[model samples]
Target: MPSSINPGATLVLTGVTHILVGLTHPRLGPPLLSMVRSGLFDSITGISLDPTSSGAPQYDRMAAWWFELAGAAMILLGISIRENINVAGYVPRGVAWGTLGVGVIGALVQPLSGCWTLIAQGIWMVGWFGKTKME
Candidate 1:
């Protein structure tokens, strides 16, 4: 089997999951109105309490979005590692394991429905480990 095939497919799938869920979750979530009023597009680049000062729920929504983006980036890093891309100090195998922890920790803060994502993350982490020959 080609080295790139496993991680390539995994990262692409994971990347799509993160990107789509992150982008759509805000509009489909509790803070839709607040996010739209506060310029949701800009918020993705950076977030401050000013936009979500209405309440804590709004802040949680933003935090979830940030995590989605970060997850996507981590997937890319994992794929890059498999490809042997020179990424300074990052190791893809480490990134893969680290994201599992992130997903587990996220469940503590996420709503019940959000636990599905965590479960999927856990499954993917285990699947990635078993499927990839990444060192």
Candidate 2:
């Protein structure tokens, strides 16, 4: 009758996976460093293609920046979930709903992404199995 899923652990694992995936990009360093150095305001210009250059240099930079940023964010989310669970003995319903909302949006925007896992995690945390308080 009990669910095998541990939402907190799952979130943490997801975060770790995200970070690892981001690290796999060969040229993520310069772009990420540039964003950091400029307080990310410089990134507002977005990706601009150089007519003189070939290939997807600009696109790759932007992609790496976003991938790394998302990975860091996911890690933070996992930490928040774990801490909340530790202190409250359960993930708040609001957090579950929020995750579900984000998951839905992400899934809609990028159907091939791992947002479905977030959706599943949200549903599990929402106490469909009658585990959480749902308050």
lDDT of 1 by residue, 3-112 (tens): 44443445556667766676567454445445667787754433355774442344555666665676577577656655642223223456556656666776777755
Which pairs of residues collide in candidate 2?
none
Alpha carbon RMSD to native, model 2: 6.6
Candidate 1 to truth, TM: 0.45
- Clash tally for model 2: 0
Candidates in order, TM-scores: namely 0.45, 0.65
TM-score of 2: 0.65
Best by TM-score: 2
Q: List the residue pairs that clash in candidate 1.
A: none
RMSD from true fold, candidate 1: 6.6
What candidate 1 gets wrong by more than 4 Å, as runs, is: 1-4, 26-68, 85-93, 108-135
Please give the range of 10 consecutive residues that has the lowest summed lDDT in model 2.
126-135
lDDT of 2 at 128: 36
Clash count (model 1, backbone only):
0
Best by the lDDT measure: 2
